[model samples]
Target chain A: MTTQANTDGIVYQLRDLSVNLRRRGQDRQILQSLNFEVRKRECLSIVGPSGTGKTTLLRALAGLIPVEGEITFQGQKLEGPAGDAVLVFQDYGNALLRWRTVKKNVALGIEGRIPREESRLRVDEALEIVGLQKYQDSYPWELSGGMQQRVQIARALAMKPQVLLFDEPFGSLDAMTREGLQDELLRVRSLHEATCVFITHDIDEAVYLGDRLMLLSGSPASLTYELDIPLTGTRSQISTKESAEFLRLRHQVYEQMRKAHGAAPTTE
Target chain B: MTTRTPISLTKSGIRGNRRHHDGKGVAPMIGLLPIAILLVIWQFLGNPHSVFFPLPSHWWTAIQGVEQQGNLWSSILATSLTFIESIIVAALIGTSLGIALGSIRWGGKALDPLLDFLRNLPAAALVPAAAIVLGTNTKMALVIVVLSSIWPILLNTRAEIQNLSPVLSSSIINLRLSGWHRLSVMIGSALPGILLGIRVAAPLALIVTLLAEFITNLSGVGALILSAQQNFNSAEVYALLVVAGLLALAVNSLVSAIEASVLRRHGPST
Candidate 1:
């Protein structure tokens, strides 16, 4: 286990992090003893089965919920929701301010923190990054689902936070749109060089975007497996997925997921 | 492989249908055809000498009679003044209190019973009490109107605030929006609900204002109608009733116009 006292390049350090939720007047443990370190400028993907508390872990790291164990960000204990991190939700319809235009929605995150002129420039930059410059004046509902998710990303990007937390942001999109956004997220992440914690249920997405992939399973879930992709150079949707090494790593993770779920092997 | 239809295609189709329906400029006038025909028939069948009902032609004479008495414009001015003042005061007080009660859990629970009792008390029943306390003045009339009409605005605003989406709240927290910025966003988002409440309350306020005038017998359209009835001036009584109906129509249209514009500007996409 890594020491929580190490601040160096780590954006987040968790030691035995646990979270309990109160449901129907009963205490239910959702996350149990999570130990991990999210390094700077790296995309960490957490993949799990549906309802396995992947979002709960992300929320805990973002300091949006209470944790029973130690979690520190840049050497300081995370007490609550900090200003240096921003979360992008899965539901773009509910996340983006419908009453505001694309520019205004992006400006929402920074308008209170900076002067008017600077906020406008930051909003434009964020919109430019997401390729939404042309639709800056359009309302969120006027845009397509993919575009609306991009606007959400722009809103978070405009904040220029050191850490970005995405909670299955592409889950609600169609397959083609989801693939398109996955690549866009990769480009934007590289451009900003910000640390990212992307949560998803899709194994392919987890392996594609993550610098390191972590699998979480079971009730009161904890980290079950961690793997590093050995494929070198820039990752491509077609070439990288077809490579033998990528296939091997993907198969290994799938087998581990089946094992974690206590399912019988498919072969006789 | 199944080819999925793009979502935008269906969305645009729905919008096109709405636009096609709204493009018929003469539809509203067509809807009023029955009323127009009814008025024409009444003009021909009404008896001029009838004490209970008068012909539409007697409207001019009744107008002259009220003008001759020098009470026509003054009565209108008094009623309009009370209605306008009461609505403004009610909107301000109701919105602030409603937001506070809705956003703060403890505040809402503490005031629930009191607000429930106040909401149930009929506005007409307060006229006598207000008149007794305030001595039948414009202040008493204003009080009666506001007390009766404030419930809709307060309740609607509170419900909207309480139902504010969790995503929006989380965004506010993640952005670290200050108190003023948060309030501005909240008020802007809740404008549609607040305006909806005001739309319902406006006509109710007007009715209550007139009721208060009729009960107090002070100086307004309601008082004029009451005096004309007592003196057996059938034409003037009927004329005042027509004017009251027109006033109600005007107030309703004005509120509807404002509600439409606000919803267009600040409401969620249809």
Candidate 2:
């Protein structure tokens, strides 16, 4: 377990963070003593088995829920939802304002905080980053699922927050659309270098997107494994995924997931 | 990509459905064809000398009598004024109370049974009670109108507020929207449901206003219709009934137009 002593370039420092939720009149421990440091401009992907409190952990980090221990952002303790951290929800259909146009939906995060002209400019720039400039006037329902998700991303980008929290954003998307969005996300991240905390159940997606991968496991979930990706340069869907390093990292994470699930790890 | 095809197809599908919904321009005129036919048949076959039934041609003379008596415009104006005032009051009180109750769990639970009881009390039945309590006055009429018609708006607004999506509420928090902004967004999203409630309430307001006037013998279209019936002026009664129907139709169309414009501007809920 890594201690909280390492504070250099760390954007978020979680110390003995624990979260317990009441379910069916019984208090269930969701996250227990979670300790990790998310660095600046780093994409830290949290991959775990289903119902392992991965979303809860993200929600706590975003200050959407009450937790027991210390969770600090930029050296200040996060008490509640802050403007510096924006969460992109998994259900885009409900997350994106259906009544608002794509541009207005993107502007929702910054509409009143800034001047009208500045808000419009930020919205335009965010839409441009997501390659959704042409669909600015279209409603969310009018757009495809992938495009709607991009609108959600555009909304977060428009806010220009310090940290982007994604909770299985592309989980509902089909394979082709998900792959396309994954590439688009990489492109956007490269342009706008905000620290990202992406929570997903897909091991491959975690390895593909994360600068450093964290595996959460156990009933009262805690960070069980953390590994820095060996790849240093830009990642492509085809070549990077086919590379020996990417395959090795992916296998290692899968083995850890199997071990967490109480099953004998298979080499194949 | 395969996804592109389905998206375009869905767009076209929406367009196709909209076109089907709009129908041809003559569809409305076609719908009115039956009413026109009924009027024409009545005009040709009705006898003016009948004590119970009068010819459609006698309607104009009956209206002329009402105009001569100086009650035509005044009755219409009185009825309309009561209807407008009642609806406005009902909308304000209903929406405010509904939102308040919906936002607070204890408030909703505490008032649910009382509200349901009041809602079940019929507006027509309240006419006699209101006249006895407050006497036959515009105030009593207005009170009856509001009491009977406010339920739909209140109930619908409350339901919509309760059904508000958690995602949108979370977004409001994440965006750090102020209380006013949050409220406006909440109201905006709930507008469709609120307007739907208002749509039902508006006609009911008019009906209750008329019923109150009839019971109270107050100054309105309903009183005029009642007096005509007592005087055995069958033509006048029939003419006033047609006028009431036209008034109701106009009110309904106006409300529907407002609802359509709002839904268009805000976009319907997904």
Candidate 3:
């Protein structure tokens, strides 16, 4: 099921994006001057220490956070919540509305602007793409954690977004379930060829999935440095994680993060 | 006796329930014995010639009188209509106002005090003042009922819509939903709260209508009860009171069932 990206290659362009949250008349710049670009069908993994504004950065790019920078989508300025980017929240259970069945939640991804029949068709097709065709009518609570996350992914896929932003979507699941989901995510994403940006603290996840990995510093968080990961073939938690190159990249990312946090590394 | 030790006298009520559930069918009937005993006491206390309550035999006759003469049907019908009219009107107005108030960020701060002042005014206290304007009829009854029933509906609905998970609000904005469309989602989404409010308002409708009837000289079950009391016809008074309680129960059950259905339809599936 091939879909079209809105642009020739570039999907979302954020130039000098900075988010400042004001509380009690005090200015707290959460993220400052975060410049990034997400190309079509590429995943950018943002790894940082906790409270480094990684999540806020994604929110800003998705137009959820109010920022001063010029954030453009398909050559148009994104002033507010726009359709080009879909955000997958960390809490998959809370993200999907419990009032709806799996099929209905997926259908919401298509939105209500289309004709009812056409929207239903798109919803059913999305469920199929996510490999949950048979469980369309199942409620989310009844499913296992992986299935629930799949339903969420199906909803994001239903939007047919040019760019997808995930805020630590798999951060809460068990080791086995989390690994399984990452596989499912990559599999379905490749099939759809949708642009994606995901935030995580896991170094291995950064190396495994991210085409470009950006590490952020803490408190007045800014992008310190970004690296490009060039790995081909089936990427799974178990298989590629043991590779020499993957470990080296993980080591590089960890060092950058430690430096950002201002922690002195003990030499043995 | 001084040297003797005491045993535990505490009755494990919940434990008894669990044991009872494990037993045969006969064990369940014991729960109803208390209610049966209470009814017997009520029956004796309510003897027709008794000083306090009218007799059951006397009430049977009054009920028979209404059934035989056919006018009982009209009077009951009249009262039920007025009661229902006031309640429906209140529900519609209150639900609408609540939804509107709930959406605005400062709506609660703006309207809470005013609503509190009006809702706290007491339905019965409003009788004399309302009677002066409404002039002793179904209109007066409806006015009282509306005042009593509308507040709970309005307040509950506001709480439900306003307190929705912030994420859903973001979802609504992200999707670029229109104003009317947003209300449809929010209202239906607020089913559990609105239903509970309606259930609360339903009983108030009956109570207010009964109280309102006391202010009016027109046809109603309240009017019948009043006349009976004036004439010292205790049996008739008791009989009319019975009918009123039964009517109230019926209305309460109807509203409850409707609320349950709506909740199931709109609420997240368990």
Candidate 4:
């Protein structure tokens, strides 16, 4: 797989990004003052424990929710859902149109805007990328959990977005499936040259898939720790993870996470 | 706890799973057993000399007599036609209006009180009013049936549309789907609910159709039953009543079959 990413320009720049949501007639802060920049063609993994507003942060970045501070996509203020950004939700079952065939679901984002022939080709190409070409005629539920999530990814890829926001896309999958999909995501990101912001609670996965990893934790989450992973180029699940650098980074992240959770460190 | 034999365990465990898988196919046939038994009992044991509780065979003979007079087929044809037309019209109106009201932020909520009052007015009560306005015709029957049946479809569609999953809704927006494309997706997402509404509305439509026909004395099976009663031909009355029940059964079966077949590709409704 090609590892060179054109990581010169900034794709997303957030300034003092705070998001408050109204629940049962009261405003609750879900994300506190946050600032970050995602470089082009880089995968930025945001890790946090569950219920730490990881999804809320992703939604704000996608321009799907109102926020209190400034957020810009490609230097433009995002007022609503950005046309060049697509969010692949974790709930693949709910994200897919069960009634639509795999091919049709992939074509959903581009059917009307693109020419019919072009749309068909794009759908075919996306299916090819996700290795779901065989299941094009099948409905989503007919496929396994991993395949359904691939279908969701294919749908987003067909849009040919400059940015792909994944909300723990493999969180519902089994261990083997998640590892396979992690590699698949890395390969796809390189091929598409798309900027990605992946949210997950899995430290190993974040380290494996991300170019830069940031820890988002707290009652109302904000970026608490940031690191640039030293390992690059094509990474296999076994060798890269077994490397000393990978272990050191993983240990550091684990300690930071324990600290974020307010747990006392164990005595050596 | 009692110790179970290995054979019994297999029967309850492995075989039980298979039975559960096959339950849907077998249950409907099993359900008909009681009705079949009831009919057989009535045929053999019921008093043939009774006025109101005529034997099942007498019902068949009375229906044959009506058929010999040539009114039976025409009445069946008219009632079936009216019911089918009413259902189609109601479905169209209900689906479109439901989508409209459901799409708007304030539309469904703002009109809830008015819709509640309107839908609560019974189809039977409106039959006379409709007949007077449309003059005891098929058109009037159509109106009454549509009015009564449209609610289920409308409300179900609205509720389904309004309750779209956040992820799915966000996907739609992110994909930049708008105009007819967006509306079509909305419709597809709400299709299971729309079909659910149709299933609920169909029987109600059939009932309203009969009510309009009977009250207006229009030409249909309902009229046949009315004439049979007025003439005090208890056997014919019983036969026509059987015919009405058979019609209801046919309608319910047809709607359910359609729903099942259509939703097969869509997966289970829930």
Candidate 5:
């Protein structure tokens, strides 16, 4: 079957995409019929309760896992990891190469593919983007949780990817650090001009960072809610979060998440 | 997050050597006090005529005499060469075998029984068998040492590979690192474990090397000790034993220093 031509702004087009995985010697369905379009250059925030197969969905989108039904990327069938896509993991400690310095880790994906000079330049640029130029020589283990996460992000950014798939990238950080990184991500995303699929369970984070939001919930998780974030212009953590529109969107997402998680939604 | 904690906080504090660095190198100096006291006591009180326990000055004289005879340096070199060669061979074989078996889902299981039996066989017990089979040559001694010392490296590497974080594996895939790059990353991640294995195997390798030499009557320090005993030269025998002890101490210190220097980049293991 042929997919639509790549003339449209859509980067990822999914149709009845289902994923059945082998878990503990049993074939379990993790994602069921997830149909959506990830728009070009848009931050698509996917929020869901814990254990709702949000990571599984992100894996399917990254083409890192097998999925039933159609999932097309830029009018082509998505198979193994795409050349222009990179992932930033939440467990930054494990995701980074502890043996390597921050600069070397950032250069990992792009090095040996490009010329040595270009690779070095790209690593320097990525570190600058993450505000980690000073820490380029330090190992990841020597950094704090927030800085380590930035290293992971810097590693991804150095690839100059078309799609940045983040799996709860700031979920482990403290609230203040998470907010700071969220702003930094917005700036980096704009500078790099890459589409992002950010997975998170935080309602406020989903609303604050997303250009658009999609929720995956229930046992065999599927897209249960979708909305365009109305708050526009430059986003600061304090002002944007305190704004009325941000509060409204955050509340709507929380209510939908409560229903999706099988918790009774209160009228109040 | 901007301020870094003291490096000692990251390392095990129970070790006197580590505390030595933070405590102005005083702990290790203090640690040598008991040995110094014992040596002083022995030097002052021990009889020079005792066959079993000769004076410290006599041991020095005996060792000097052996050195003058030209047997001391060559014997030490031979033993050191064998020990070094066996460790290198064992590390290569062990790491390769470990990565191969650990990568495959069923490889380790298939060889479980054989590995268990081989690893349990005493290194000393295998010395005579190896001497008979390989005719007591350097190659035979190498095989015996490697057979005993390889278990730690192989086992540690395998466990590390098996326990490699899934996030790192997925990151490797997502980054689309080429085959060579992937292997480099894999080896880099497993290096700490491999180094740990080498640290454990160093002492075992030394013991097996000495045993192989002693049992096979090969030309090394072990042979010198054996010959000194046979000739009823108690002073030379005691001197050679002290030399052997010094070798042990040196190997341990060297290996630990190397391990620490390398692991400094990799961070303290967990």
Candidate 6:
């Protein structure tokens, strides 16, 4: 076992997972015979270069993608788009049910058709977790990108799913807003302690948010390497991005992505 | 809960603030300018003594004469009742038929040619046929109005439903929203288009009513126009034309107002 999977409570085990995707006129095998296991309540970020199928692999986990793979959750054979593993797409605005109020949209993720009172309580609780209880009645279009993302998070959180999958959930936001949202997400994850798989092309975001980093190759992408981030103090957004270990991981992921892309890392 | 409420309020507040700042009031008034100008020009051009058609004042004189004779309101009442009856029945039939047509693609396709042919039939030509079937009575008037007005509403709604966004359907299906829940959320979302179809048909309703009245010789504005023209009361003819124009304007405005309210209620979420 890798030292990473050596931790407690294995939440998911993906066995020899392979995914092939076709876009436009070309068919490519993106995830080629990959094996990974996520432990209970651990936050893992999958980072890779653009066109490296980071999002595609995340979708595979969410069961949104049709792949040749076996994903088991709590030792149960998974079905397609497993409701237990909910996905939050990066386009928060589009992710939400625009017609529904924020409260109702959050309420949408609640499992099963339940009593009104129970759904209401769950909805309120989820909104509170995302710090968005105030905007419950407003529509998604009204909310800013960060707030919309919070609504998305709130909705996913409401589902009370075993796994939370984010496909670059903050990729569409501005730098400052994305940073704030990253911190907000981290705080929410810390509080809820849900198993998370976040995929992003951003090296810094992967370093900042992940417990373990996953790098991927370019075209017909495959997992390149994995690294663990060590932290010793209270991590805040601004400070952590500038932290030494964070920078090291960030640099390493950057170099790996460049190498996978067959290019030298540009001095930016 | 409390925190999210603040965000909602803040968002609406920001939107409200932006709208107030961006208020360029001239555009709306520009729309009204044409009507005001046209009314003025029309009123003058309709002068009987003048070279242009006949003064609107002359039209007013004829209107006053009809009011003097005191059959104006009664005849209008007679026509209005038939108009109302035809519209309610047509709305029900058209909306229901549209739903059925929208639900069945092949059926709609098969009927498309027939519906197109029917829609193209000139009201003037249909008058004699309807008159023969229903006789020269108010019922005949009703039939004419229904035939003329139903097609626009039925066709538009069917097209709207057929062209509904597929994204919404999949989303609802994914969520397992079936039966009543699915219809309410999914079909209800497309209400803007349905409401728009109704709004577009509103003008057709009035036009058909008038045309039907003219066809059946029923006592209405259409009959009034024919009578005036027959008696060579050009002033009365112009007056009847003006009243018809006003009625058409009122109906159109009412539909527009209704459409606006519906759009506001449905919002941009559709």
lDDT of 3: 0.74
Candidate 5: segments with Cα more than 4 A from true spot: A1-7, A264-268, B1-33, B43-49, B268-270
lDDT string for model 5 (B155-265, tens) is: 777766766789988888888876789988888888767776787789899888888888888989998998888888888987898889779877867776676676667
**Residues A78-102, model 2: lDDT tens digits:** 8988558899998988787777889
Question: Which residue ranges in model 6 land beyond 4 Å of their true spot?
Answer: A1-35, A264-268, B1-52, B65-174, B187-194, B212-233, B265-270
Candidate 5, position B163, lDDT: 64
Considering summed lDDT, which 10 consecutive residues are worst modelled in model 1 chain B?
B1-10
Cα lDDT computed for each candidate against the true fold? 0.82, 0.84, 0.74, 0.85, 0.84, 0.71
Query: Tens digits of per-residue lDDT for model 5 on A87-178?
Result: 88999988999999999999999889999999999999999999999999999988999999999999999988878999999988988899
The better candidate by lDDT, 2 or 6, is 2
lDDT of 2 by residue, B1-270 (tens): 221122233234322433332443355548778988998998888775787888877877998999998999999999999999999999999999878877987764677678767888888888888888998999999999999999878877776777678887787788787778788888877777777778778999999888998988999999999999999899999999988988887787677666666667554334
Model 4: residues with Cα > 4 Å off, grouped in runs: A1-8, A264-268, B1-30, B107-109, B268-270
Docking class of 1: medium
Q: What DockQ do the predictions score, one after another?
A: 0.55, 0.50, 0.31, 0.74, 0.81, 0.16
Stretches off by above 4 angstroms in model 3 are A1-8, A22-27, A109-111, A262-268, B1-36, B44-48, B69-71, B265-270
Query: What residue runs in model 2 are displaced by over 4 Å at the alpha carbon?
Result: A1-8, A262-268, B1-50, B53-60, B128-135, B266-269
Clash-forming residue pairs, model 4 = none
Top DockQ prediction, candidate number? 5
The 10-residue segment of model 3 chain B with minimum total lDDT is: B1-10
Q: What is the RMSD, in Å, between candidate 3 and the native fold over all Cα?
A: 8.4
How does chain B score by TM in each prediction? 0.85, 0.87, 0.82, 0.88, 0.86, 0.78
Best lDDT among the predictions, by candidate number = 4
True contacts kept of each: 0.61, 0.57, 0.20, 0.75, 0.89, 0.02
Q: Candidate 6, which CAPRI tier? A: incorrect
Q: How large an RMSD does model 2 have?
A: 6.4
lDDT of 4 by residue, B1-270 (tens): 111122233224322333333355466567778977998999899997999888888888999999999999999999999999999999999999988888899875688877788888898899878777888889999999999999888887777777778888888888888999888888878776777678778989888887887888899998998889898899899889878888887887777667666666676433
The order of the candidates by TM-score, greatest first, is 4, 5, 1, 2, 3, 6
